[model samples]
Target: MSGDNPVDRPNGDDDNERPEQSKGGDENNPFAAMFGGASTEQFAQMLQGFAQAMSSPSSGPVNWDLAKQTARQTVSAAGDSSVLDRDKRELADAIRLADHWLDDVSSLPAGCSKVEAWSKAEWVEATLPTWSRLCDPVVARMAEGMAAAIPEEMRQSAGPLLGMVRQMGGVMFGSQVGQAVGGLAGEVLGASDIGLPLASPGTAALLPANVRAFGGGLGLSEDDVRLYLALREAAHQRLFVHAPWLPARLLGAVEEYAKGIDVDTSRLESLVGQLDLTNPEALQNALSEGLFDGDEIANTPAQQAALRRLETLLALVEGWVDTVVTAATDGRMPSALSLAEAVRRRRATGGPAERTLATLVGLELRPRRMREAADLWKRLTDARGVEGRDALWAHPDLLPDADDLENPEPFITGASELAEFSDLSQLGWDTSDPPVEGTPDDNAPEANGPDSPGNDDAGPADGESPDGPDGPDGGEPGTDRP
Candidate 1:
């Protein structure tokens, strides 16, 4: 038998057997021979052994590679294959035409007018940064809370194990967000479709095939539909690029709300104790329901307020987008309203997207106030010229509150007075109730209550609580608990 054939010899045969000089190699390691028969598996085992000896834990941080790969798989599952060359060219041409038309209507600078086509997967790659910025705060909180929940005794004793577990948590969250973002990519036709500047600034993007598919059942000519969508995309980029601070302000609101996510260590423990993490769907369900159960930990008023802010901000952004897109469309497509309604329904009834994001970090990345917001913006734009309307974005104080949407005209046109749309800062409400002398920072953990995790790092105060206070967080509960 050839020497390579290890099984040829009898079990006890020692003749012709040679002891490897390399003392520390796992015998079965595939890479043992590359380093003078040192098995990589053996090296890992030895390192693990050393860690065990030292009682040190290792490994944490997300596996971005795996997350991105899984996101691609999610996109594939969505099956958006409609972007052909002709469709892309037609979409680009339409964006150019729409930009020309919008120039006559408003003074917003033309943002990268070269329209690009993005496949659903491409969309994910492009927009994942925005998702990451919005998601990382909460995910970090969740992961750290998980890390902290381990008793100090166990953390010190099982350092390596703890580290490994934390790394696994990061990887797990990354996968979760990727899947959710991928699913969202299928639904969105452009950078700002969800009103969060999901893609890079200045680059107007569209999913031609998806747009065509979205408009297909409406029975609109593909050309007209493409043109209409292009206008929407152009309009979004114009507002986003021109109003430089708006994106950060809006994104900050989301981050602020997420900062309030107090990891219910109790719920997390229960989930970690039972769920099969290898099965991502099961893991997803556990993550979504865990942190989002705001009622369980509705311990603080700050959380409630943060939730409200996020909802209101979401409403304003979505409302503005809807108003502008509608104006740009000029009811150009016979099916414009139909398509809008379909989009609204799709957003209202989130499919896998809800599960995907919820699992990642317990944020339900949806605009619950889209319809109300849309109606408010439509009325406002009708009353105020687009420039007059866009002036609202000049400062967050000018945006409508959740209450304002209920009776928009008063806020929309009747009150040019800054007092109505303005906040405690500009409305002089700040002086009405200064923090009592010796009052601790409200951003600080309470003096007597259960501590708010990392309350110190709560993002900018001008957070977007969105319009509806009702979130997976208690009503108006922000995905806000960073």
Candidate 2:
């Protein structure tokens, strides 16, 4: 027998036997040349590696660790510079003083228990958990749509392969989230730059590097820019802390919107079938262009309402912060007005990262009526003091509705009147009752006619003295009345 024969080979070596040599035309076979004529063992190893990757524990809708790692890598690759110690100290001092200044302007007390300066990477790490909360609902919906895209019969036949598909979906969603967050990290100036409480409670963080970049071309002092940004951040922290229900309310709107997400199964199925797993860039492009494109999904009426609510709430928060920060920095920073206008313009015209986030979540963070909302807040402050203005946050019902933004006069007037009424009630006044009809009006002519009680001069005209002893000084008699 030949040495290569199965009879002479080892027990396990039989499965590894090579095919008979091909003719000269084999050299011209492109497929063989491309893979270097991969042997059966090599292909098996590749499949094994894939299987191992697929078998990773399916956490939730996203592989969070992978997402974090990818975000850090992305930030690193984007050249996120470290914050110098001096800059860090300056940031801390600025934030602290900003909080102090805010205390004078806003009723909400200082909320930041700790302040720190961060690099872009640190920002990603600190804010990732909040992003997860914000993103989970949408990502879960996408994962469900992906799984449901397959027919029941096909899914049953897929067996273990179905798990692999789910794992792949997690990876894909995680990658997209990482990309969005990394892009945002490079642009955000602080934890609350996006008008959401992205950082942990009692902690205020600033990105010195990003702050420096933002102030570079404005011809403004770096200190003024940092201080202005710090005031905004500090104001956000105060509002979020004082209004305990706000965070949940904002997040609930996002989730409510997410609940209405319905993916087009046909398009998703087609995309999945055509996805090129070997090329990550191709997969990302396909996802963005095909699966997540406008044509692939549509929001329901409820989702639209939820989005409106979210937008209004965001606008209110940002507007209040803007008003409060402006007040706090009014005289202290000479460049405050210019900085405020710059910030407004920046927010009104969002950057690429914000747009990308909107595309991904189907919810725009940019408050369309931010200016109007800010005006409303300022009107409220002018009509009602800071206490009355901040009291609106005491209850959701007290906050201004979308209609209130169109003409804030009614809302401001009503709020001020209500506050005044509340004060009267607290002082034991019966505001419900009508005023005494004959009560002397302070601005009316003096009551000098005969009908008045003080018309004693006419009544006693015939008397020797108009003022009798008892009438003038309440003496018992005219004798010794002094």
Candidate 1 lDDT over residue span 361-478, tens digit each = 2334344345667787677667765555665655455567656655666666675643344332343221122123344323221211111132234443344353322233433311
Worst 10 residues of 1 by lDDT: 1-10
**How well does candidate 2 match the true structure in TM-score terms?**
0.73
lDDT of 1 at 277: 37
Q: Distance from true position, residue 224, model 2, in Å?
A: 0.6
Worst 10 residues of 2 by lDDT: 1-10
lDDT of model 2, residue 376: 92
TM-score of each: 0.66, 0.73
Among these predicted structures, which one has the highest TM-score?
2
Computed on alpha carbons, the lDDT of every model, listed in order, comes to: 0.54, 0.62
Q: List where candidate 1 sits over 4 angstroms from the true fold.
A: 1-61, 77-83, 269-294, 297-299, 351-368, 413-482
* Residue pair clashes in candidate 2: none
Kindly report which residue stretches of model 2 are placed more than 4 angstroms away from their true locations once superposed: 1-56, 273-289, 292-298, 365-368, 415-482
Please report the candidate that would top lDDT against the real structure: 2
**Residue 118 error, candidate 2, Å:** 0.7
Q: For candidate 2, lDDT tens digit of each residue in 345-400?
A: 66545543234335434444443467678899898888888877877775455678
